[model samples]
Target chain A: SQQGEEDPQALSIQEGENATMNCSYKTSINNLQWYRQNSGRGLVHLILIRSNEREKHSGRLRVTLDTSKKSSSLLITASRAADTASYFCARTSGTYKYIFGTGTRLKVLA
Target chain B: EPEVTQTPSHQVTQMGQEVILRCVPISNHLYFYWYRQILGQKVEFLVSFYNNEISEKSEIFDDQFSVERPDGSNFTLKIRSTKLEDSAMYFCASSEQALLGEKLFFGSGTQLSVL
Candidate 1:
């Protein structure tokens, strides 16, 4: 039941705009991972931010972790139509299992 | 980059019937896992496998479900007497090291429909 809550369940943005989503979990975690999934496709790894680290980046994706608040945020800069997908945050706490959030559904308009 | 592959992109089965979902994890990977997502729902972990044995399993993975590495390259999840609620998109993933530290490579996923 460590399921996290992702704000702005759905988002819409222009191609040149930036999209930001927030995730808040219920328990402490060692590392938090971000994943993206296109409709009907498997989830793809975007980035991973450890509890000790505050922020991590990969290409246009930026992930920030706030362990004290049990929350995290993902920012996509200059979004593209292809970047449209559901983004999820997953974390594990002293276990081999990962609990995924409901995810933020993003749509970028050209 | 090596990829995890799952067989039968989609599966349709009758309730009370048995269905086996097959997956071939990255050859060099040592850890395997199975996860499923019901339509419009969050992804749920079913089980994790390491060293040819189950490392961990969630409460959702009840006695009706079982996993096996029948051969060197294959990992399978068998659901006995499938129920309607079993319908979901099942994904298979693998990682070279412990998932807590390593990113996983996931297969395209197998859509299971229990009719």
Candidate 2:
């Protein structure tokens, strides 16, 4: 079974707008990491938030985690057409393996 | 920056034939992993290797699937007999550590097409 499920399976926004995607997991995790996959490409590590941390930022990317709710959200500010890709949240529990979410396909129209 | 690399950007094999996918992880990384993503499906974990042994594997990794770190720098996944359902994009990843919080670096992936 999948441990994490992403909401708004698909999203489309005009360039310069903000895009937010949410993910809910089924169990406690040591950390949660977000990744982006461009069409026909490999997964690209974006950012990671530890269980003890509530939020993290990198350039235009912001991620928030609420362990109490077992959920997390990824925000991309001032989106661009180059930001178009499928986003996935992976939850890491007490192991080296990461359980990935269903993913959210985001499209940034120019 | 160092990056994981996979060979044969695309592979085409017939059902019942054996196939071997190769990967070269970051030079100094100690943990290696394999993942597969079927078209229109989520990325699925296949197996994790550490200390020259398999640390963990998912249910999708069956007897027909095998992994080997043949030398110090190369990791390979071998499927004894390919099946049509096995066609997917196979990604190889590596991490500097085996801890839960370590980030992974993934290769571009090898698209497997089984006929």
Candidate 3:
């Protein structure tokens, strides 16, 4: 199974604090993407970082990829209650398929 | 701001029955996909379609499963026979291109319950 695994299956933080999640996969990948799912809702694409890139940022979200280690991390800075959701990391190898991780449940307390 | 749309937010069916889940992907998107997540489990890929044909499919997408574009705007997944283990949330997704790093827009999903 090439599915990625996310550490710290759950995390809790205050509104003003930063939250981070890590993902590790078993095989090489062409790119990695992070997505957020508000309970019972569709996944919203957050950001994507290619294997050649080290880091990318979008508004309050930051993503880092390390192809050498087959691992990636997502950081949400200045988290808010609205940021409370399940975050998943998906890796795409040479195919169109995206293998998703187990996901990290994040809770942002007011 | 186009988005994928799925019909029948929830469906309940008995084992051995056939059910077809429908989805309408973004208007301009060329790539379409179906994925499912069993309760308390990670999301798993089912199939990917492009050029009106299946480009890739996961092991879970066995003979019991089939996908069809059917028309210009609708994509459908038909389960030949539903089983107790078939209960899951099915999500439809689409992207303008099938490139390695392109982002996919997903639909809200349909929760299927097999009894």
Candidate 4:
């Protein structure tokens, strides 16, 4: 699968700390999104940033996209135990084919 | 909040057998998609369906795999002859619009194990 790659395949943080993960794709994208998946569960959409937008925020989650570099980063501020899950960055252009990046597995200790 | 729902949370089948994973997307969603993830692997797109026809499919979606929206609400992915490699977590997702940009709401997924 020639998809995207995420850095720090895994991360561990304590509650109240911040966790960040980066994603890079090979193709052009019109929009990108972040998704969270609990262990053995379905993925839930978190946030999305368009190609023109540099940053987007939703509550404690912040996402930044760099079109020039074809990469994006997700930041979870004041991480909590409930925020412990795998995060994936998905990219899509003007087509139905959406590609997902390798995910970052975060373990938040209480 | 509306949610996409998949049936038979888990399935165990023998090789060469046929299996159909079903999903019922949110009533108003217009676009549907199928994705699979092998253990410890990233999610891979299989097929995208809209207006009762396939819009796009990945290389992984070969001849043995087919998708259909039998009625107004049920979408299914059928594997004619299941292979051992087909063992993975198959997820059904739907977006309100395939208008090129929209977030997907995925089902809990059906864990298929081909023995």
Task: Give candidate 3 misplaced runs (Cα > 4 Å).
Answer: none
Better of 2 and 4 by lDDT: 2
**Tens digit of per-residue lDDT, candidate 3, span A1-110:** 79999977999999999999999999999889999998888888999998999999999999999888889999999999999999999989899998999999999999
Q: TM-score (chain B) for model 4?
A: 0.98
Candidate 4 residue lDDT tens string, B1-115 = 9999999899999999999999999999999999999895699999999999999999999999999999998999999999999999999999997577788999999999999
* Residue pair clashes in candidate 4: none
Question: What is the Cα-based lDDT of residue B98 in candidate 1?
Answer: 70
The predicted structure with the larger DockQ, 1 or 3, is 3
Q: What is the lDDT of residue B63 in candidate 1?
A: 96
Compared with the true structure, all predictions reach lDDT values of 0.92, 0.94, 0.94, 0.93
Tens digits of per-residue lDDT, candidate 4, A45-108, equal 9998999999999999999999999899999999999999999999887787789988999999
A-chain TM-score of every model: 0.98, 0.98, 0.98, 0.96
lDDT of 1 by residue, A1-110 (tens): 67988888999999989999999999889888999999998899889999999998899999999888889999999999999999999887887777889999999999
- Candidate 3, residue B21: how far the Cα is off, in Å: 0.2
Per-residue lDDT of model 3, residues B46-88, tens digit only: 9999999999999999999999999999999999999999999
Better of 1 and 4 by lDDT: 4
Q: Cα deviation in Å at residue A7, candidate 4?
A: 1.1
